[model samples]
Target: MNENDKQPDGSGGPGGNPWMKSLLVWVCILLGLALFVTVLGGPSATATGNTVPYSTFLDKVNEGTVKDVTISREQIAGTLSSGEKFRTVPIADPTLVPTLREKGVTIAAQPAEGGSIWVALLYQSLPLLLFLGIAFFVIRQMQKNSGSGAMGFGKSRAKMLTQKEGRVTFADVAGIDEAREELEEIVDFLKDPTKFARLGGKIPKGALLVGSPGTGKTLLARAIAGEAGVPFFTISGSDFVEMFVGVGASRVRDMFEQAKKSAPCIVFIDEIDAVGRHRGAGLGNGNDEREQTLNQLLVEMDGFDANEGIIIIAATNRPDVLDPALLRPGRFDRRVTVPLPDIEGRLKILEVHMKKVPVAPDVDARTIARGTPGMAGADLANLVNEAALMAARLGKRLVSMAQFELAKDRVIMGTEWKSLVMTDDEKRMTAYHEAGHAVVRVHTPASDPIHKATIIPRGGALGMVVSMPERDNYSYHRDKMFADLATVMGGRVAEELIFGHEKVSSGASGDIKQATKLARAMVTQWGMSEKLGMLMYEEQQGETFLGYSQTQRHNISNETALAIDSEIRALVDGGYDKAKQVLSDNIEHLHRVAKALLEFETLTGDEIKRLVAGEDIDRDAPGAAATTVPVSGTSIPKTRRPKGPFGSPAPQGA
Candidate 1:
């Protein structure tokens, strides 16, 4: 019998004979009933007469009180003259037969029964049979769990996904149209290979999906399989590697063998970088087990034997670490980049997720998408789910726009720390700090437009000033970097101007840290400083291995490093001076905005502008009439700046 035919429960597997399983079950039940009858009936079978001592039996026999005697090997049974029966163990005597004859006692012999012998044999062997059966069962379970029944240690762990219901197709996927288009050709090839073959085009052997995490790479792979209506096999890269050497290679061979049986199938290996790292990149010839596995994978993918109908799709965020041989043309012919969604893609993703819930008419997908600039499809799904959760928590019938706004804030800015209490003086100081950021952003020509200012504690910040870009910007301009540096320094500048230099608090530490990082990036990485020229002063280092540097080749001299530091410091100082000037000139406007924040705890950009123009805001009314403040000194051009949700690290006071 094949090992695969045996099940863990000692029953038959799918391919096994059904009648055999039924016969085994019936045999076990009969054996149990027989054992139960034997145990319960054994003691009562000979429990009929009274047991007497040997002396009493002999005395009775000599007195002729015993009428008949039935003698066995161990004991004697007899009937007395009073018509009572008794049994006893007898002592051997040479004259016993003569005495019984003299007494005229009828003598009879009792022999062993054949049925008792068989019953004894069954009782003795029952425990042994039970033990053997249990051992067989446990071994079968172990084999089944090892993945291969007889070939235990070397079977592929890839799971075949038979999407009977809720199968994902291209229609279910959003926010990654380009990636979908790249894999669509493979689907078409799988469905009808002749269309491509007529044009002398071979189907791509493999396609590598490269993107950040949560960018829907794996989902796209599944969509391809669903579109073609073929078998899908999925596994992780880590599943191929094991502690024992050669096991991974064996598994790889076995995996391809299985895939061949189900031709025209899609095999997805998620996070392929785990086993596909560059060979000999680590210390002392690198990992032998992983390297061997990767070699086997490369061969099975595109080696001597042509795998005609199998399409391999792998997903990994760390494409830089993968081996080049595995990424060659014949192996992975196409590299699809699944990037973060743009505004329109985000809107589509939101709309897709929104369909799953009951949303009010006031909830706008475009507005939420605009607010979330760098979010991926997964993030947008979470955002919609969060809004629904918030609505449900409030016991509302439908998810409204207010719930979405709150959910967005919670996701971007961290949950509001409502339990954190602040004294009046601290609140006042935080209000002033955020007001400084708002004023600087409003007056700076190249800065992004301010979205909201709040004194409420969120995440690690005591207060935050959020800015939103008019549109997505890929590359950063020098003016925008300078504007960002100045904006970050505004909190410290405001504190010094309002509370005096000696009374400045440590709440500006976060702002100072943000400013330093921005300035250093501008000078060393972005090449924005004139003194540093347009050359990159800092080298991009390779990823670390085992807490040690993989490549530490610093070409710059000590003097050059010192010069770079000086340039970064100069940039930061220039930003501080610029912010000081801006805040000092708009001192009155700063106070007004701060007072409004203290009153409302949060204020929108238009409200801040209205406050600057000496207009009263009606808290109860929407779109209250307000006058626009004209720009006087700096020419505030409406240029776009790329800023993430809550401005990345955010312009905040710690």
Candidate 2:
């Protein structure tokens, strides 16, 4: 039979659910009828006038003889002639009628007035009574089983994914090569049982998949089940729990037994830590039922009964809180980490998702991968889908590189909040502010070249200048940090240069946040501050939850923290002042760029570069920046200041 045919009847296994309880009650009823029949008389007897004449006949006759008998009711008489007759004596064993018939006695019948009322009532009501009883019992059991709508406290909340139902194979799973290679071996072992058995290698009872959510840990489990071609039972750790005691333990037992029956199968429990958390780590109420569930899970996993062909695969993002017993050698013998996709992995993921999308010739997976650093598989998938949707909205046949870029921006910053109203003055100030950023970026030596700039509002920003890296870069130098800070201050400086102290909106709020963080790290974290002199104030402690760190820095005292904060603020202020000075020196160039923005709403990096070099940025103007001058493809490169101007070495140093 195919794997699909082997799906256990959804009570999740071959043994039907609690319907057996109803069957048991029915069997008892049938047995009761049989016993009553045996003690009363023989099967051939029939009741005569509510009295059984068969008792006397049974006492007097041998098993093989015909007999005559007389039977009487309250107001009627009946006679049976078999060559002899006696006075009518009525007795009360109505069940003896069959026995009299068995002796070959002929009895006379009186005209019937009414059928036996009690017998008729029982015959008519038994079926309905049995049905109602079974139904009520089933409802009660169902309610109790589900804990009256409360999942029992001890139940494991893992999700089940059966092999036939979940269709993810290695091809379907993208990214995370190391995790896939490790799990592929499990699938191989399951597919060829003897290969390991001949070597006397005991199968591991469980393999724990540890990683952050959206890293494809659960997806890996599904792929294993698909490759194994066996029953896959999926459940979440929380699914096994309930408010009632013992339910989680019972579920564990049931799950294990089911896995054993479907030997050579995979049982995937996602988020196993819900029930497998360390004991006594909680508020330590001795009555805590999670502890019981965890204890039972340990016993089932490493207990005396070897879990022969059943392989348990579980996933948890929170591995730190898992019980030690659950991670013991005999229990979860292997742990496979599914980390975020690196650059190459991200590219591969893009390709996998790209096959489903109709993309333009210019849309390169490599280009998208280079843009999205530190993105997980889930995010990459979203990027591809978003690009397709964007193309559709623009009435394009396929997604182009432009669509991909726009989608990336949408994902990074939220979608543009277009309806937010701004005055003409605010818009003009925003134009100058963004032009300042563009000018500083193009003029900065260490900055990545600007790809595009826009004064059109997007994601709560009145304008933005995008400067993407030329290729994948893992590390940033100190020069890059300072250039980044200068770019951040470009807007504020431009405002001061053009408006001469007119109030500038807090359009740079987010920029200030980003710049300040980088600056503080330069001082306290990276020790790039000259006054601090290479002494790291906060040690490079990584991978904390949110911003909460377990590794406390020893050297950073209250006084030091204050000093660090002061240094960071001073660094940002200094960068801002430098940007203002640059803008002051080039106020005329700043106005030319802003005027072009207010007119065109957008401009390319090349066009803005010419305008900075004293050429007309407007297409209608004489010697416009767009008008090509016949010369070599390149020219004398100007010596521009760095973009951030001191913002480097701090954020990326570690």
Candidate 3:
């Protein structure tokens, strides 16, 4: 039988789902009755009776009109003189038999019945049997719905994959080459154990993949099974920890028992932290179903031999909370960390995802990868799908670069709020705020190049300025930190510049919070303050056992705390002053960019750069207002900066 078509013996088949067996039992019982009737020739010659009046029945007996009579405890039934059967409810009298005898009527009392004891017993027990059958059916149904039957809380919920099912192989996966390399060895061992065995080598009994969500941990496991041409058993950690105690332990044993039969197989348990968390860390003593399951898992892992060819792989984002015993050498001997993909990795992932889609020739995967930093493989995959969907929404033949760019923006900044309406004053202020950001990003030496500056409302923000990093940055130096802080502060500073501090909107609230957070981190975490020496302060000590990073432990004195707060304030003020000075120096250029943005509503990185350089950016075309050029592509038409607002067209040649 196909592996996918079968459930574990106790959980399925005739012994488990007994409808067919019950039907068969019913058929046998019916057939037995039919045979009994055929052999016994039906009920034997039952006497038929016509109910009569009691006085008439007695008068008939007295007049010699009765032929023979049968008397029972309640009624008199007998044949009359004309050979007609009669029955009547007569009074209970001791003289009834004597009166009938004196009337010269032939009467016979009913003889003692044979087999009546067994008949009465059968009749009496029928309702009890029926009640039991109904109760058993209800209980059985309840068990099936709750994923167990009777005391069957121990059944394994692992979904087995046959050869024809879930055919994902190594080709389906891309990026994370390091993780693939470690897993390929397991596949090789599964395919040809003799090669590794001859070298006195044994594969790891299990591999634990630790990573954030959407990093393709489970996908990599299935790919291994596909490459090795072995069955795959997939289960979740919660599947082990059921409501009943010891159920989880029983399920763990059953899962391993199945995996042993399908040797050379891969068993994948996703989100294993549900059951594998550090025992005794929660409230109370922590001897719960989850703990018992974890114990059983430890025992099963220790019971299995690495050379047995049944490899177990588990994935969890909360690896810090897992028990140390569960991760020991004999258990999960290998720990593979599936971190998010880097730029090169992301580019490869995008290419793999684009293979199934009809992509435009102009769409470049490398360009997209460069713009999307610190994205996981699954994120890239979703990005590709979102791009395709955007293209299809426009009724386009193929997914284009335009769709990809828009999709990236939506993914990063969230879906646009196009229905939002803002006053001209609000629009002008937003333009200036974003322009300030763009100006700082361009002039600031360590900042990434401004990707796009737009007053188009997206998510919660009225305007956004995207900075496309030239490449993936593994580390941020002091200059970068200063530049980032200044950029964040620029929006609020611009609002204060254009609209006075009293008139400034609350839009800068988020920007101010971000600036403050970065400044505090600079002084406390990075130790970048000149006054404070190179030492890290624990703002919050994380609990490794609980899988949470929230506990404030004071490592410094109250005086030092005051000094740290003072240093953070100084950093923010300094960054804000630096940004305001830059805007003050290029005040005319900042207005020009804002005017262009008012006319066009969006500006590309190159356009902002050209504007900052004081180059002409007026497009004569009429419909060029809503669109902008790609980062590396040809520029679209840009209308002349509107003469209205933004301080009367930048003061001409001033």
**Predicted structure with the largest lDDT when compared to the true one:** 1
Candidate 3 lDDT, tens digit per residue, 316-340?
Answer: 9888889999999988999999987
Question: Which runs of model 2 end up more than 4 angstroms from their true locations?
Answer: 1-166, 193-205, 283-287, 393-396, 533-536, 539-558, 585-589, 604-654
Candidates sorted by TM-score, best first: 1, 3, 2
Give the per-residue lDDT of model 1 (tens digit) for 1-654.
677767765455664454456447657965885767577446435635789998888899888799998887657888999999898877878788898999999999876554666676777777777677666666765677777477787999999998898699999899889888989999889989999999898988999999978889988988998899999999999999999889899999988998999998989999999999999899776788999999999999998998889999999988989999988999999999999888888889999899999999877788778777777788788888898998999999999877887777766667677788899999999889888888988888898776677887766677777666777776767778778788888888998899898978898776776677677667666677788688766644656566332423257888888888899899999989999999989899999999988887878778887887888777667544222111111101111122422223434334
Poorest 10 consecutive residues by lDDT, candidate 2: 632-641
**lDDT: worst 10-residue window of model 3:** 645-654
- TM-score per prediction, in order, is 0.84, 0.68, 0.81
lDDT of 2: 0.69
lDDT of 2 by residue, 1-654 (tens): 556545364343466465675577767985675555444432114434333354444564445344554444532233333443333345576655676677666655554324445445655666786787677776767766554444433333334564445488999887788889888888888889888889898767789999867789878888887878877888888876777778778778877876777787888888898888878776737536677777877888788877788888899888888878889898899999998777788889999999999988867788678666556888788888998998899899988877787777666545565676778898798778878887777767887776566766655456667664665455667787787778888887776666776676676665776688678668866767887778766654434576343444665578877777788988898778767777777778788888877877767667788788887654657755333221111100111111122322111100
Q: Candidate 1 vs candidate 3: which has greater TM-score?
A: 1
The lDDT values for all models are 0.80, 0.69, 0.75
Looking at model 2, residue 401 earns an lDDT score of 78
